[model samples]
Target: MKEYLKASSLDEALNLLSKDSQLKVLAGGTDLMVQKHAGSLSDVRFLDINALPSLKNINEKDWGIAIGALTTYRQILNSDLVLAEFPLLAQAARETASVAIQNRGTLGGNIVNASPAGDSLPVLLVYNALLELQTQKEKRNIAYTDFHQGYKKMDLRSGELLTQILLPKGNTWDRSYFKKVGTRKAQSISKVVMAALLKMNGETIEDVRIALGSIAAFPLRCRFLEDFLKGQQLPLLKREELDRLIEQNICPMDDIRSTKEYRLQIVKNLVWDFLKA
Candidate 1:
């Protein structure tokens, strides 16, 4: 690293990023520091933004919930607003490693890291989370589903930084569920994870959103499966039909943690289990 700087405000951070495209912004340092210890960090400058108080707030907005980019996992787990309204997100927050790592892992960092196995990505995708990005010149909102481009890749531009996460009308979800299949329960990264939000009218499904992680290059919504389940009664949802739908929609790849076949099978089971439960 050529230099280290700390931004006192969001504008300061944007100014620095605009001037130096190679400057890496560090929020919690949980992921960045790991890369640094592993000698993976390239020669670049560091801009620490942990002190920016504007980026650590959690407030309810007319759109929905506004989670400042620097909000930590532990904070999310303990937040009454988050737990009551976005239980799936809070559940994902609780399952992120242990208390120690959660204290240092920011929500924005997890999204920006764009890890295939990231526990929060699927939940955000299911809720249709929106990202607030800012630069010295402009500010914009991008859908979370569109933010991720590929493995460890995102739509973030050179002179921009992620500012906040907006959950638009997500609290209106009827029933939300999140499940992660991992080596253990807590500390291990997920091999296959699913997040579902369902709104049912009596026995018929009114609206549904489903997202899966560690089954593709990036966490993605199961739109085909969602479309098939909507307006259908629970009795009409057959296991074999759901199984076929999942197999046709998802594209999983074999990796160090699990096999492609295993991920595919478990994803099918998880979707069924979530609906039944």
Candidate 2:
């Protein structure tokens, strides 16, 4: 009843998309297949692009590092460039589901899925990542901050496919941390997650970036908190001010996984612990 086509190349994929308005791109099929099994998608035309060579590379360029959208979590965990430059991303990848899932789930899929509890989203936000989208006509790059539109929504348009993720290549983060609180140690959705990047001069924080997930409608960057932390010494990080700031900035909703009150407390504790560390 449904048509499944394996794209022979990137061009073929784009052409298929141009022809079939209802066609969906399939990467790892980790999330898409789940939606399929749930009957959320019906009479779907799947354009399989997992084998498209243009979307399967991890390249280091003058602009920064370019990670192909099709790159799997397992590959990211094993990439030397990822380990040396963006270890938090690799750490997030390692925290994703099981080894089997990691081997199949792709970075692009995680991003496009745009789940509030996605582990990698916070890390990507911390890195100020950029996404490359391509179509039969042209290609464009969108900042990660501008990519997510709303709950389970993105800036992606019809006939366009996400091709790569670009992360700046540098040592801006002298100290970094990532933590996720889930129902279980592994294979569970996060109730609250945090990713922090700090650039310090001695004990003074010259720069800082903090991002959180599962505590909001979508992954969020705490620029206000980061601005407050900059040029401040770690020892001078007052708990009262920190708590007040978090309470003022974040208003997490009560969901099936966690309560709003619980999420707020976790945010306070995590920020306090991170500063102390």
Candidate 3:
């Protein structure tokens, strides 16, 4: 392990990363610290980003919502404004490990980790979140769908820092909910998770979004399921239709935590249950 520079400002951190390609940015240090302790720390300089004040805020823009990268899950969960506007996100955040982890684990780290089982990723996907990345040159906003390119891989470049998450505003998403299957409630990791958001026109769903986690290489967002239910009246969307949507959207694999068949069946039931409610 090489001795790394700890920065006090975003510019200072960018300057180091821009100068040396070997510098890796560190925020929250939840995942990184654990990896380092396990002898998996990569040989590189660490650019500490904990001091960037701009990366610790939440603001509403004229067109969208801006959530700073360093904003902890606890802060998000406790935010009344977020609860009112993005209840699905709050619901998903509630299912994360425990209070202690929520107080320290950040939104940026969750996205960067790009885990298939990240509880909040599916919620972000439902919100159509975008990432604002800052570099020495300028700032760029990338769609969340394009941000995570693969498992543990992101589209972010060297010298760039994910500063904020942008979610569109003024859209009515009623019937938004989150569900997850875990061994126990507290501090337990999920075996399968799903998030659904819909806009209703009378009894028909006008627009909808559905995302599933822990069932694929990355959190899967299937707009097709939404499309299928677009014009279907609530009374017409039978349980069989909900079950068919799940099977069509996922081909899950059995893992240490759960069986593929079980996840599929549970996901199908969750959709049916939500629609029925």
Which runs of model 2 end up more than 4 angstroms from their true locations? none
Writing each residue's lDDT as its tens digit, candidate 3 over 1-277 gives 5566677877887777788867777888878888888888756567778878878887877886689999988888888778978888777777788788888889998888777888999889988898999888889988898887777778988778888998887888778879888888877677888888877888887888888888877887877777787888978877876777678777886888889998888788777766676
Residues 16-80 of candidate 1: C-alpha lDDT, one tens digit per residue: 89998788999999999989888888665789999988889889887689999999999999998
Give the TM-scores of the predictions, in the order they appear: 0.97, 0.97, 0.94
Q: Residue 79 CA error for candidate 3 (Å)? A: 1.7
Ranking by TM-score: 2, 1, 3
RMSD of each: 1.3, 1.2, 1.7
**TM-score of candidate 2 versus the correct structure, residues matched by position:** 0.97
RMSD of 3: 1.7
What does candidate 2's lDDT look like per residue over 1-277, in tens digits? 3589899899899898888858888999999999999998787888899998888788888767999999999999999988988999999999999999999999999999899989999999999899999889999998999999789888988899999999987666777899999889989999999999888899999888999999877999999999899899887778998899889988997999999999999999988877787
Q: How well does candidate 2 score on lDDT at residue 101?
A: 94
Cα lDDT computed for each candidate against the true fold = 0.90, 0.91, 0.82
